[model samples]
Target: MTLDDPTRRRAHRAVVVAFLAHGVVSGSWFVRIPDLRDLAGLSDGGLGLVLAALGIGAVVSMPLAGALATRHGSAPAMRWLLPPLLAVLALAAQASAPLTLALGSLAFGAALGAHDIAINAHGVAVEHERGRPVLSGMHAAFSIGTLLGAGVGALAMAADVAPRVHLLAIAAVTALALLAYRHLLPAAVDRHRTAVRAVPPTLGERLAPLRRRWLLACAIAAMASFIAENAVGEWSGVLLRDHRDASPALAAIGFLAFSLAMTVGRLTGDRMVAALGDRRTLLLGGALAGTAWALVALVDDAGVAIAAWVVAGLALANAVPIVFRAAGARRPVGPDGRPAPVPAQALAAVSGLGYAGGLLGPSLIGAVAELLDLPTAMLIPALLAASIALLARSATGGERLPSTAARSRPAANASPTPTA
Candidate 1:
């Protein structure tokens, strides 16, 4: 219940609100899956292909999402982006053609990716302004939102509400949340104006910060951790039903447990990071995640396996936020006191990679599960968590370009002001 520092409290609240919206919007789609499959008369593989289209859209959109976010600021971009998402979700629910559904999925994915980039970019900005670690808790709000959305959607389904209708209700809820939250969302504080670009600045002096090995390693760790988180969130229900011999209702509980545990973990992550430091926290997370997966893969009992899934979710919850905070704080300063490199943009690029992996998680898990069984699918997350732990940083400074690197900096847009 204790929020972060008061200076960035509004930003933090905005992040939590946006994430809650994401949970409802994203979860509403999953809630409608049975109807979508029936409406399209899709075989299991066929339906999966449709779902894969959503992932493909997210992958394709991430880079551009980052650029747009940087240029426009998260406030304006998110305002423009979310409406389309609701529309697309509705369209996907009602589409008669596979092509139409595919298109809707693309829009859905694009909106999701765009929202993600804008919000997280905005988050980094807020974190920079606050000079502390708050990203993990914001992300934890996302996990909580997901859990709530899924839970509400499930209850609607139990009451026999049609998928399309259920989604309409969810959309209404999201819209109301947006309206309620609009006034509270923070505006971009970096006031210097520059021409927004369609393509991200690839060669700007700003790109200098990412030249270090540390940045690359952190990026890779983020990618791997995100892949683990997304795979479990998206596929845990499927695994339970298909491999563990659970009823649909029971299988859903597996995902709920996973989501709820993740939420609780993330909610507590800021405190953990404060106490344990990012390195030790990452190490502990990796061990817990790996052990949980190992249990899932090796165990035959349904209840025990579900418990393991929850453990994994909790273990993996805060890992990515720590990585993002580290990445944002990675810029080496030059001697003259200017940022020697494009620190924000570099973090954005690394985040782009992480987002891509997250989008890929579901399809990759599905493909593996199709061939090797659910236990094998579960192993992917274990391996990924271990890799992330290996790559995670021991310590990092706040976003200060080292004094040595500051010597070569171009004058700020005005007085060499930081990025928006």
Candidate 2:
């Protein structure tokens, strides 16, 4: 909230690490899943059962994140949650059986869910505090991080680096980097000033936002976004290598293309919101992604499929961020004209639901693929992309980024007004 502090800019820059680190860990783990499967010596069905623990852990721990983010703000949560998150990766790397792998995966999922909620809450806080839309860019950092982690994974494989060693090295580097970048916006000054007060929202008050129509709509829209996003993100590699008969090297390009498109879309998302407003931005994103998925469903060629992934990357860049920003901004303004402290709980709830979609998305695709083929399964994402229409009037009507003049005022005056 210290708009004039020299370190304020640094704080914004620092928050991106939370997102980037997560993406790196995730990308690294995803590429190394085969190693994990082999280490555990599990059949595909057994591996699938253990993997469910990850989603379960993520869902179960999110509410706890709500409490932490509300009470402590981003810095403490980011700093503390990360080491455990990093440690879990090493634990999973060393797992030698299904039970051990499942336990490690559960811990990893919990940490991942908690960190994701905390950082995104921070991103929204930073966005409101800075008076510009930075969530999109923070998300872009995640995509870039994924690309970097995947690149590292590829290099490690080429050099014959053991998966356990690769994971440990990345975790160490990321943890050290965390120590160096400890200047995230302070809890005292962060716009969620309820931290400074004797009173914070009651549990009922915090939970009340979830009952609202718009928030539910946002959650559903989030589900759709994740479904569309993962259709390509989770499966394109398999589709290319297994279905399209591409070489291993060529199949890797599927992920690269998806990640690059996401980076491009997110890098531009803030400007898109600034120019067009949230409703239009959401509408455009839905249309573009829906159309792209339809093309992917109809087209049978690998080139067309990869091209569709690119389009989906571009289409969904800002969808989830926009929903999250709105959720954080939903509380009523005070009589004195300062904005309400952002309800980290609300953001967490939406995220919990949104991630449910992410968890379901892959299975949904696989189920469809099993019943028919991968191309026909593409229709599911297309439908979900088109279903991103939960944009109710109460939740997201007439929302636009603040004007530069509005943002130039003092902190109390500059606080983002509740939207609903």
Candidate 3:
């Protein structure tokens, strides 16, 4: 598609709308969890288990989501998937029993996994058509939505809105956004056009061999970044409250800073990636994130630690998008005559592993904090991010640049001319 093409603009708009809805709703979910806990009369440990259900469900569903996106084009899957997600979101807010919330959380997680894959698959196709960087911008929109969602939910909570009411409002807004943009999603062409054919597989044939070495490497990078980021989300507040004696209200600032920084970073990421290329972008981002963790872990001053945590968000902004771009970058035709490693699969694998680490990060950090201190616990994330930088460096040949021809491609759709 040419830069001036109308269809391309519409496709981009559709993606942005989908992203904004998904982000805001998802962010509000986090903000409302405390209310859910209060309504259920659960303790921190019990609440943790309930939250873990969401992660487990997401991990279980990701592989299936990838397969679904492969068989059905992303647009079709999204139309079917989102309404159910909205229903689950509503159900979660209204659950009366722990068991009910658990079930709702599972459904919510599954929906999220499916939505994540479908949207990314859509993005891969869009980016391919756009020729330049579109993936990062789409992701950036998700962060922006997250920030908005969280703020809205927080405001409602501060105003004494019930969890159900707050969630219902978010759902209404998100559903409206989805409806508004639904028309712009890519229409179903031959699902096989991108590469993978939808033939039934034998019992053993269902599992495709992982041949795209680069994609595997991208997953590894994703694993590192997600693990570190989720750790901060799960543990930073605890550190502030426990070690620094900060009030619960103030402790929340850690995540706010992280989310806000991440949003700004993503919004500007495409420009950076377009100019500097992926390898260097990852290198710089990884270093900044690692440094942020290190400082937050070692510093005693609460203000300093909080500042460091906030800065960490900026460091992390581009890493995930770069990894997504790497995963999504398939040879138009792969060597095996099959569609190359698609973004859906990469996202699934990476998200699954990353969520697992999200669970582990807190547990490990808690153990270390028990033996030494919370600051010492921070060291683990710092080191983990630093190590990820090394892996990314090796994966990308330690700072290779994009080819001149690749750089010169029209800043629009990267697709080949359509057959008449």
Candidate with the greatest lDDT versus the true structure: 2
lDDT of 2 by residue, 1-420 (tens): 345545666777887877888878877876666557667886544555565677778877776777676667767777778888899887778888889888987888888888888788777776666766788899999888877777787678667788889999989877865853577877754334343336544545545556766677777788789778755655666677667777656666767777788889989888887787787878888888888889878876778878888888888888988888767753365212444335576687778888767765666676667667777887888988877643623346345523211455364224443232
Stretches of candidate 2 off by over 4 Å are 1-3, 34-50, 96-99, 190-207, 330-342, 370-374, 389-395, 401-406, 411-420
lDDT of each: 0.65, 0.72, 0.67
Q: Runs in model 1 with CA error above 4 Å?
A: 1-8, 31-48, 96-99, 184-186, 190-212, 330-344, 394-420
lDDT of 2: 0.72
Q: Over all chains combined, what TM-score does candidate 2 have?
A: 0.86
Backbone clash pairs for candidate 3 read 129-413, 129-414, 130-412, 130-413, 131-413, 131-414
For residue 5, model 1's alpha carbon misses the true position, in angstroms, by 9.0
RMSD of 1: 5.7
Ranking by TM-score: 2, 3, 1
* Candidate 1 residue-wise lDDT, 83-155, digit = tens: 7777777666667566777677777777787677666666665555544566777788788778887787778
TM-score list, all predictions = 0.83, 0.86, 0.83
